[model samples]
Target: MEKNAPCTTVCPTKALKQDEVTRVVTHSTDLCIGCWACSMVCNYGVIGRQKEARVAVKCDLCPGREIPACVEACPTNALVFLEVKKLSGVKRTEAALKLARGMQGKAL
Candidate 1:
């Protein structure tokens, strides 16, 4: 079982639930009381309270979408969705290349 967040734990109506398969957190509008408990307890501050609906909202990882809208809209290729392991390898390679270039400049 996934760990319960403080936000989810405090939800009175059980409006928020995490999918076991995807680990995606979702809010059920029907069950929500608009109490803002989830929004108040979210550590990342990703939860948003909609003034119109008064219910908390958050990213559900863009379910059913091939690519996230933010990533797709980025023009500079600066934003990327990558696994942590791959990102770590890339960072390590970049650091090594930077160090090698500095050493080469000193040797010149």
Candidate 2:
């Protein structure tokens, strides 16, 4: 969650916004015009077009909830919410762990 998100900065309708304190990016369908500007500018591809509604759609941080629905509802704990600054470290750690594990093959 960049302080100045590309999607929010590129949006003509100001539909996408980033919180200065939390650094959480939010998408507002009410203000969205379905212009696809956010979708195009978003590097993560989280923003998408809702063809039926003719508006952009993205996670709004679950509004009143502490955690997003997808993160909370994930049965396999696949999805996780993290601060932007910590994301790189997390990815690095995951890569290191995978590299260390490698291919075990058969244990004869």
Candidate 3:
């Protein structure tokens, strides 16, 4: 992230990572408060809070499901379930711009 990047994720240690270094995010389902921090904070928006799961879970992008949850739920057709390596240059630019804007008045 740039120096102006926003601290949108409000975790105790700001446990957000840049890319899917882990490919999948696994956490204790019982401990999640469904805060939607992963959804709000991630530039790629790989994670989201689901009422059905009662916790935040990141995308596995597994087959058999027609679309990922975010892509399916996006009303404006914003979210796309694209393979990370196949993501277009434009999408990456847009994500970076949005994250910079989110930084706004934050000091760090």
Candidate 4:
């Protein structure tokens, strides 16, 4: 788990926890206090409020399913599930390509 993650850090009831084996962050509604701190601190803004339950809600990556429903339902395939390292590598490759294209017009 990211030690500096604001959502997890600010959760007063410790409802958010990262599984050591799966490395998935899990939320325990039973422990949640309806404070919305997790939703407020979520970087991706995926967290939401369960209006009926008065508790915070977020994606659990669709446990027991091979692919998350969101990813499967995206018609344009805009959403992708990838490991952090793989995503970082893809970003780095894109940046390098952009740099190379920009340098093509320069004297150097």
Candidate 5:
């Protein structure tokens, strides 16, 4: 999750908080007052509204589940669940591979 997303910061009821261990942003529906403050400030547009309940909704990473249902149900594997450090390592490896390929047969 974003280190300091506006949605988390603007939540008046403190319903949204980031898990220090998982780094995942969690939402407490009980604490939510449907103020829409979090939704308004969400830059990623991930926050949604429950019209009937008047409560804001968002992916909470399926607490207590190994993988979120959304990620598991994705047909094309477009949605992936990875830890922050693992994702960073994957990106770094990709960059290194690309750089190595580009430097092939090209001397300093």
Candidate 6:
């Protein structure tokens, strides 16, 4: 949820997405499957299908950490990270929609 993730809205399963062309990272939640496919393919280890969410998830640019472990480990700087201004209209819309969906209650 960096700021401008396009794939978050586009994903049919609501699984994963990069913030934008520039972010070059991904975000995941409890829907991961632990497939390890994302970790295997991406040069930056930007993907991981964990068991919690039963789906794939990735980088998500560690905000609190002073430095990312992956970035420090990278030999070629393939995963340069950046932060964006929170002036996100699309993000607000999507979050609003998600919140509304939550109010509907969980599926039985």
| Cα lDDT of model 2 by residue, 2-103, tens digit | 767899898888888888987788887889888898888888888878999999888777878888899999999999888756877999999998976774
The CA lDDT of each predicted structure is 0.78, 0.84, 0.58, 0.83, 0.85, 0.56
Please provide TM-scores, in order, for all candidate models, with all chains considered together: 0.63, 0.80, 0.36, 0.69, 0.65, 0.34
**Poorest stretch of ten by lDDT in candidate 2:** 99-108
Tell me model 2's lDDT, rounded to 2 decimals: 0.84
Error of 3 at 67 (Å): 14
Q: Candidate 1 or 2, higher lDDT?
A: 2
lDDT of 5 by residue, 22-93 (tens): 667778899999998988888667789998898889897788899999999999998888866788899899
Order of candidates by lDDT, top first? 5, 2, 4, 1, 3, 6
Off by over 4 Å in 1: 76-108
Task: Put down candidate 3 lDDT per residue, 1-108, tens digits, no spaces.
Answer: 223223233543344432344244434455566766656766665566678856777545443577877689889987776655566776789899999999999998
> Which predicted model would earn the best TM-score?
2
lDDT of 6: 0.56
Question: Which is superior by TM-score, 2 or 4?
Answer: 2
Pairs in steric clash, model 3: none
For model 1 the local lDDT of residue 3 reads: 57
**Worst 10-residue lDDT window, candidate 6:** 79-88
User: What value does the lDDT take at residue 27 in candidate 3?
Assistant: 47
Q: Across residues 1-108, which tens digit of lDDT does each residue of candidate 6 receive? A: 345444454555455655455554455555444555545555434455556656666655566776787877899977544443343555687899999888897665
Which portions of model 2 miss their true places by more than 4 Å?
103-108
lDDT of 1 by residue, 11-108 (tens): 99999888767656788888887899888888657688887987888776677887778888999988666554687789899999998988984745
Q: Which stretches of candidate 6 lie over 4 Å from their true place?
A: 1-3, 13-26, 32-54, 73-79, 82-108
Reference-based TM-score, model 1: 0.63
lDDT of 4 at 73: 97
